[model samples]
Target: MAFENPSREKIKELLQQSDTVAVVGLSDNPLRTSHSVSQAMQQKGYRIIPVNPNATEILGEKSYPSLRDIPEPIDIVNVFRRSEFTPAIAEEAVAVKAKALWFQLGVYNEEAAAIAARAGLQVIMDRCIKVEDSILIPSGKTKK
Candidate 1:
């Protein structure tokens, strides 16, 4: 079966409940989409954990090479990598027991989505977390 994202209400609930977002493939370059989107998420009060082997730090937060490298529990694993790499990231997210797995806009992988879902994690694909937050979060208020 093809993968489908959860309902809007469910997405909103996931956003509301999640606080820490581990951004895979996040770039140190400010102009990159991954950097911009993660910055926006940080502005919305979500702690952005940059997961990129190349970066030491981004947006003032320590960067982990991969999900397994993060010491703390992750609420969401938001991936900015290409679709081809998503399945592996999904597996790592499951290994780390992430609450949800989110693929950024323009990135979609049904296999990865299925894996995450089977692991009992909320799955979001081809959507921008910052955009979703702005739209579904009541009154555009930043999460605390």
Candidate 2:
């Protein structure tokens, strides 16, 4: 079956309920899209956990080399890596019990989506989380 992203309403709901976002492939460079988007989310009250092997930190949050390395519960696994890299990330997200698996704009992989979906994770692909948040929750998410 062809994969479909969740409805905008569902996306909005997820954004509203989720608090901690683990950004995989998040870059240490401020100019990178991952860094900028994560920074924006952090400003909007989401806790952004940076997951990058090469960096010690990004956006002032300590970076983990992989999803399994993060010690806290993750509400969302927002991926900035390429499509080819996502299936492994999906597996890791499942292992870590992430609430959602989000593939950033231009990143899509059927295998990854299926893996996450089978694990009961809300899966979103080929869309920008930052853009979605800005449109769906322009006022920003409320603190729980």
Best candidate according to TM-score: 2
Tens-digit per-residue lDDT, 61-115, candidate 2: 8999999999999999999999999999999999999999999999999999999
Error of 1 at 89 (Å): 0.2
Report the number of backbone clashes for model 1: 0
Q: How does candidate 1 fare on TM-score?
A: 0.95
lDDT of candidate 1 over 1-144, digit per residue (tens):
677889999999898888899999999999999999999888878899999998889999999889999999999999999999999999999999999999989999999999999999999999999889988984654546
Over 4 Å off in model 1, which ranges?
A: 138-144
Model 2 off-target regions past 4 Å? none
Query: How many residue pairs clash per model?
Result: 0, 0
Candidate 2: residue 46 Cα off by (Å): 0.4
RMSD of 2: 0.5
